[model samples]
Target: MLQLEIVTPEKKIYSGPVHDVYLPGSEGEMGVLEMHAALVTSLVPGELRYTVDGKTEALAVGTGFAEVTQERVLVLTDMAAGEAEIDEAATEAAIERAQQQLDQLDHDHDLEEVAMLEAALAKSFAQLKLKGKYKGLQ
Candidate 1:
């Protein structure tokens, strides 16, 4: 098994051994099994899955970073949410809200506002992708 730990500024979301893990990379989805080589890479907004004690659990994660060591996998991200924590309606609403802001913004938009909107869009996309893949599990 591979030790998996996920952390955010708010709290430590998870810490334990998992048989396998899949992360959404900026390039594409990546799967790591036991004894995988060490590496650190950026992740994009998408679904993250890991099998723990025979049961597979999925999470919606936003763009961030992941470090894979010989024995442990550490993920640091701005957002991480399980199925229960993810509200589809709320996420969809957030996408709409962000889009509205983008539309109303002036010709010369604030960089901070633009970044916030982009982040919101990524988060919402991750949720939708996770929900789509694991509907029965969710």
Candidate 2:
């Protein structure tokens, strides 16, 4: 098993042993089993899945950094939401809000603001995807 820890600025979301984990990467979704090779990579906003005690759980995570060692996986991100934490209506609103901001952004808007908006869009989309996939199960 691999010790997986996911943390966000607001709290330490999850910490436990997992048999495997799947992350959304810039290139594509990737899976890591126990004793996998060490790696440090950037994570895109998407669904993160892990198996524990023969059951799998999923979370919606924002852009972050992931450190995968021989026995551990550490993920630090701005946002991480489990099924119970995700509110479909709120996520949809956020997506709409992000789109509105992006649409109103002027050509001369600050780069930082633009990036933040983009991140919000990504996070909201991720939540939407996860919710869609596990709606009935949840």
Candidate 3:
């Protein structure tokens, strides 16, 4: 078993043993299992999945970094939420708001603001995708 711990700025969402773990690496998706190599990598907004007790669970996570060791995996992210924690309507509204903000930016705009808005839009989209996937399971 591999000890997996996911923490956000607000709290620690999960800390337990898992059979396998998958993360959205900055370049692409990657999987980690017990005895895997030790490393650290940046994570993008996407779905993070893990298998525990023969059941696979998932969470939508925002920008962060992950530290993987032979026996433990630590995920430090800006945001992490399960399907039940994501509100579809609210996520949709957030996406719209972000889009509006991005659209308002003209030829000369603050790069940081644009990046922040894009990040927010991407995170909101990830949440919506996770919610949709869980709904399909119902």
Q: Pick the candidate with the highest lDDT.
A: 3
For model 1, state the Cα shift of residue 8 in Å: 1.0
Cα misplacement distance, residue 6 of candidate 3 (Å) = 0.2
Q: What C-alpha lDDT, on a 0 to 100 scale, does residue 38 get in candidate 3?
A: 98
Predicted structure 3: clash tally: 0
- The window of 10 residues in a row where model 1 has the poorest summed lDDT is 129-138
lDDT tens digits by residue: candidate 1, 50-115:
998889898999878999988898999988998877788988999999999988877375878888
Candidate 1, superposed: residue stretches over 4 Å from native: 106-109, 136-138
Q: Which model is ahead, 1 or 3, in terms of lDDT?
A: 3
What are the Cα lDDT values of the candidates? 0.89, 0.89, 0.95
Residues 39-109, candidate 3, lDDT per residue (tens digit)? 99999999999999999999999999999999999999999999999999999999999898888887265
Per-residue error for 35 in candidate 1, Å, reads 1.6
Clash count for candidate 1 is 0
Model 3 segments more than 4 A misplaced: none
Clashing pairs in 1: none
Ranking by TM-score: 3, 2, 1
lDDT of 2 by residue, 39-99 (tens): 9889999999999999999999999989999899999988899877789998898888888
